[model samples]
Target: MTGWTTANILSTLFGAALFPFMIAVAWGKMVEVFGAAGGWVAGFWIVGVSWLLNHGLGLHHQAGDVWIDMAMAAFVGLFVQSTLAGGKPGKAVPALISGVLGGLLGGLILSIMA
Candidate 1:
């Protein structure tokens, strides 16, 4: 909270929102695959994918130690994934809202930790 730079703020928002945003995108698929346990499975899949991307795509987002990846609220879209997959333009509101919230809250949490 003392040294909150624009980079930190932006990074937290991006990192935290990344998981939920992805969840929203993949939620429908997860549900389709695991039936009742898709949410949990998706969460794990998210981390695994992030790790792979971090290595494959070089997503190095660990500034010192306060790296943000809050998947708890991923269900916020519940996510944009379904909307995207469903091809419903209007339903994208929830997905967008969730992403915004995810970014804000994630930034706040990271700021506090920092």
Candidate 2:
């Protein structure tokens, strides 16, 4: 097992930090058209499908820990956003923050135990 470290965790977190924002920007229209809940539904599906395409298909290795971290972040973010948004959800910003934080935490653990 590898050891977890603060540096690696930070690396992962920072690396993924801007990803959610980009995703939000690109998909913002779809989300707005669908409404918050609908946006989440579509967003989650997109995330899942994209993960499968990228990870399952081995399209890229640079995003190695993305799936797990994003999943964790998305779920947690969804909950937090829904709560904070007062029924309406803001997917991109929250998801990005959540995903980055979650990814960093996951990377820390993985690096430590890997």
Evaluate all candidate structures by whole-model CA lDDT and list the values in order.
0.62, 0.55
Which residue ranges in model 2 land beyond 4 Å of their true spot?
Answer: 1-26, 62-114
- Among residues 3 or more apart in sequence or in different chains, the pairs in candidate 2 whose N, CA or C atoms overlap within 3 Å are 2-112, 2-113, 2-114, 3-111, 3-112, 4-112
Cα lDDT for residue 22, candidate 2:
35
Write one digit per residue (lDDT tens) for candidate 2, span 6-83: 655665454344334335444566667777876687566666665654445433234345345444444554455446
lDDT of 1 by residue, 22-106 (tens): 7656866788888869978876777678656543454434455654334433544444555556667675679778978988997
Clashes of 1: 4
For model 2 the TM-score comes to 0.36
Q: Which one is best on lDDT?
A: 1
The TM-score values for the models, in the order shown, are 0.40, 0.36
Q: Kindly report which residue pairs in candidate 1 clash with one another.
A: 24-79, 24-81, 25-81, 75-78
